[model samples]
Target: MMRVKPSAFVMLAYLIFLLLPIYWLLMMSLKTNTEITSTFTLWPADLTFRNYQTILTDPSWYMGYVNSLIYVGLNTLISITVALPAAYAFSRYRFMGDKHLFFWLLTNRMAPPAVFALPFFQFYSAFGLIDTHIAVALAHCLFNVPLAVWILEGFMRGVPKEIDETAYIDGYSWPRFFVKIFMPLIASGIGVAAFFCFMFSWVELLLARTLTTTDAKPIAAIMTRTVSASGMDWGVLAAAGILTIIPGALVIYFVRNYIAKGFALGRV
Candidate 1:
C-alpha cells in the first residue's frame, strides 16, 4: 500500500473544494430539471442531454455564443495589433511624461467597467454601431489595449535593444523588422495578451450586454436572461455554463506553454 503525505491530502481536499461547483453544474446539466429539483445526489439518477439539445437548437440561445465569439475574436485582433507598436515604443524610448503616460494607460484598466459602460453605449449609439459585434469589440479595446500594452512592454524590455540597432544596420525597414524580427522575439507576450483579451471579452457581461441589444448579445448576457414565468431553467442554464467554459479551456490549452513562460518571466 502507498502512503500519502499530509500536504498531499491537503492539496487534494483543496482541489476538490474548488472543483465541486463545476462538478455539480456538469451533473445538473446531464439531469432533467424535474430530477434536479426533486433530489439531491452526487451523480444524476437519470441522465439526459435534452438541455444541450434545446440550447443548440434554439436561435436565441445559440446566437449568443456566435455573438460572443465574433466580438472576442475582434477584440483579440485589435488589442494585439495596437499593442505591438505601442509596447515597442514604451520599451525602446523614454520621453517627457512617458512613465506618467504609461501609468495613465494602466489606470484605465483598473477602473470598473461600470464606469465606462454608459459612455461606450452613447458613443457607439452615436455612430449607429450599437447591436453590432464590432461595437462591443471596439469598446473592449479601451480596457484591453491598456493591459495588452502593459504586458507586452515587459516582454519587450526583456529583449536587448541591440536587436533593433542590428536590424536597422542590416538595412531592414521599420515595418519589416517589426513584423519579421521583433514580433517573434516576444511571441509569448503576444500569446499571453491575446489569451487575456479573449477571456475578458468572452465572459464580460456588463459591456457586452449594455453596448448591444438582441443582435450582438453575448452568451454571458443570455445566461442571465434565462428567467421565465415557469421559474428559471436551471438545467439549460447549467448546460450553457458548461458550454461557455469550453472556449476558455480551448484558449488556455493552445496558450499553455506561452502563459507558463509569461509567468516565469514576470510581467505587469
Candidate 2:
C-alpha cells in the first residue's frame, strides 16, 4: 500500500469537499428539471445536454457571454494601463504622503460595491454611457485599478533600484526604459494583476446588472431571468454556472507558473 500521512488524508478530504459542489453542478446541467426535482442521486438519472443546447442556440444567452467578455477585456486593459505607471511611481519614489495615498487607493477596493452602485449608475447615465459595455468596464475600474496598483507595487519593489539607475546612465529615455527594460522584469506581476482584474470583472453582478438593461446584459445577469410560473429552471441555472467557470479556469491554466511569484511580496 502507498504510505500516506494523516494530514494528507485530511487535505484530500477537504479538496473533495470543495470540488463536490462543482461536480454536482455539472451533473445537474446534464439533467432535465423534472429529473432534477424528482430525485436525488450522485449522477443524473437521465443524462441530456438540452440545457447547454438551449443556451448555445439562444441569442440572448450567448450575447450575455459576449457582452461580459467585451467589458471584462476592456476593464483589464484599462486597469493595467493605468496601474503600471502608478505602481512604478510608488515603488521607486519617496514622496509626500505616498504610503497614505497607497492605502487610500486600496480603500476604494475595500468599499462595498452596492455602496457605489447608485452613484455610478447616475454618473454613467449623465455621460450617455448607460446600457453600454464601456460603462460596465469603467465601473469595474473603480475597484480594479487600485488592486492592480497595490499588487504590482509589491512586485516592483522586489526589483532593485540599480536597474532604473543603470538604464538612465545608459542614456535611455524614461518612457523607453520603462517600456523596454522595466516592464519585462515585472511580467509575472502583470499577469497576476490581470488575472485578478478579469476574475473580479467577470463575476461581479451588482454593478453589471444595475448599469445595463438589454444591450449590454452579462451572463451573470441573464442567469437571473430563468424563473417562470412553473419555477426556476434548475438545469439551465446549473449549466450557466458551469459555463461561467470555464474562462477563469483557462486564465489560471495559462498563468499557472507566474501566479505564485506575482503574489510573493508586498504582503500579498
Candidate 3:
C-alpha cells in the first residue's frame, strides 16, 4: 500500500472539519429524543423517520418551505433582471459618478440585515405589503441586486470590445445583439449570480422573518417557533435545518461547473 502525502492528509483534515457538523446534524435528525438526551452515540441507537414525517406532514412547517422557494425564486429573478442592465452599463459605458455609483451599490450589501428590519417592516406595513411573499422578495433584492451586479459586471467586462463593434457593423440592433449574442457569452456568469441570489435569500432569517407573518413566513422563521412552553424539539429543528439546505444544495449541484468558469471570466 502507498502512503498518503502530507498535502493529502491536510486536505482530508479540512474536509472533515467542513463535513463533521453536517454529519452531526444528519445523525441528530435520525435519533429519537431519548437517544439524543441520554446517550452520546456516534450512530443513533434507533433510527426513525418520524422527524422527517413531522416536517413533511405539517402544513405550517411544509408551507414555509414552499413560501421560501417562492420568495427565493422571485428574488433571484428580480436581481438578475435588474443587474443585467446595470452591469452592462457599468462595464461598457462611462457616465457621471459611475465609479462612485458602483461602490455605492455595494454599500447596500454591507448594511446589517438587523438594522433594516424595522424600517422594512414599517415601509411594507405602510404599503400594506407586510406578511406577503413579494415583500420579502423585494426586501431581499437590496442585497442580492448588489451582489448580482458585481458578479455579472466582472463577466461582462471580459467580453471583447470587438464583438460589440462587429455586431454594430453587421447592423444588429442593440436589443437583438444583447439578447442573441451578449447573453449567451455570459451564461456562466448568470448561472453564478442566480445561485448566489438564491442561496442568500433562501437562508436569510432576519429580514424574511420580519417581513413575513402567517401567509409568507419562511422555514427559517418557522424553525424559530420550535421552542415551546414544554421544551425545544431538537429533532424537529434539526429536520427543518436539514430540509432548508435542500434548495441551496440542489442549486449549487447544478451550477457547480459554472462557478469556476464564471470566476475565470473575472480574471480575464
Query: Which runs of model 1 end up more than 4 angstroms from their true locations?
Result: 1-3, 261-265
lDDT of 3 by residue, 84-159 (tens): 9899999999999999999999999999999999999999999999999999999999999999999999989889
lDDT of 3: 0.90
Angstrom error at residue 59, model 2: 0.8
Model 2 alpha-carbon miss at residue 188, Å: 0.7
**Candidate 1 residue-wise lDDT, 1-268, digit = tens:** 8987999999999999999999999999999988988888889889899999999999999999999999999999999899889988999998899999999998988879999989888988899999999999998887889878887888998999999999999999999999999999887788888888887778778888998889999988888877898998999999999999998988899988787655543354
User: Among all windows of ten consecutive residues in candidate 3, which has the lowest summed lDDT?
Assistant: 259-268
| Number of the candidate with higher lDDT, 2 or 3 | 2
TM-score of each: 0.95, 0.96, 0.96
Q: How far is candidate 1 from the true structure (C-alpha RMSD, Å)?
A: 1.7
Better of 1 and 3 by lDDT: 3
User: Among these predicted structures, which one has the highest lDDT?
Assistant: 2
Q: Give the TM-score of candidate 3.
A: 0.96
